[model samples]
Target: MCYAKKLNFKLKTCTTLSRVNALSSVAVKFAAYLCTIDSPDIANDYLKVQSLQEIAALIGTTSRHLNRVLQKWTEQQIISRTDDMIHIKDWQAIQEISEDIRFV
Candidate 1:
């Protein structure tokens, strides 16, 4: 009976650890996507604050669509754009979003 109880406790601990690892994996994925916001391949260039038209061309998107995306990103505090210039906001804010918008 004593051995059985010990085994059950060990199993519970293992299960809890597995859940933590799973959540970490999800967090990593979220961060990975967020990191792409300032990628040169997307908006890194044209740093002089070019027009949205230029940024759209670089990213292969329409200026209108890019505008909408930018608005949402800004509201989320992920990115900030004034006129044509794009600025990356707090990495911590993005990281916090990554950590929070996760699955169980």
Candidate 2:
């Protein structure tokens, strides 16, 4: 019983860490995408089409989970969303969130 409990605890911890790492990676890449806000890559007649499902697939996660992460960013005013489009409210903050990585 003791061994089972230890193993379960380790497994849960590993799962949690994996989720955190994955979410961090997604956040970084998402910020990079936002950097293209004014370019043709994101601009479609001045509206960026950023689909949650597409981004989730790129980040190797489900859209439902990615949505939660995005919601938190939205709550903090990091990004604004209108339907499937998104606009970065603070590019500098996003760069900081992405650990100062070059967005180009």
Candidate 3:
């Protein structure tokens, strides 16, 4: 490829990777937010947030996408949902998934 074409391809590749990374980050951040709020010390695993829509907005993702992720987590036995509330069943797993991302 010509230099310009090579550069363009590289740019496109970088952009695609960035987008993928960002999407993954959103999930991790959301999980981190949940793990952060639910404290074992308080014996509370339920999320205090009002709605999945609100959390989706906060994480810059669609509510449908958030729900899908939640479903996957539920299947993995990482969490359980009742109505609007989400209970973290595997806090350690979520924390591990969240990696270095921690809530303030």
Candidate 4:
């Protein structure tokens, strides 16, 4: 897969820990840097992915509300799409427009 995997600033934690599961691998990498707009609302430690219904139950909000929140974010271009999946362009872009970022 052509992943736009940001050079995670949290690499130290990743290397220090032995077991980085699929969910953790994605969540921690995102949380440490890329989770600004495209992040899930839940504090996904070890990434326990609950169904939409389960998530709605925990947060006391319907899935429709959550979808609306996500849709607004998409419209802002604060986050973006890639091959039907979300990808953070870079860690640095979290604080600014993605287009304003430059590699130095």
Where does candidate 3 clash, by residue pair? none
**Which digits, one per residue and each the tens of the lDDT, describe model 1 over residues 1-104?**
39886587556434433443343433243343345444445442212224667444433347777667667778887778786566767678666555533112
Model 2 per-residue lDDT tens digits across residues 1-104: 39886587556434433444453566775665455444454332322334777556544568888787789899999889997676779878887766643223
lDDT of 4 by residue, 40-65 (tens): 65333422233544333223346676
Root-mean-square deviation per candidate: 17.7, 12.8, 12.7, 13.1
Best by lDDT: 3
Minimal lDDT window, size 10, model 1: 41-50
Candidate 4 global CA lDDT score:
0.38
Residue 81, candidate 4: Cα error in Å is 4.9
Please list all clashing residue pairs in model 1, or write none if there are none: none
Could you tell me the lDDT of residue 30 within candidate 3? Answer: 77
Candidate 2 residue-wise lDDT at 83: 79
Cα error of candidate 1 at position 58, Å? 2.0
- Residue 32 C-alpha lDDT in model 3: 64
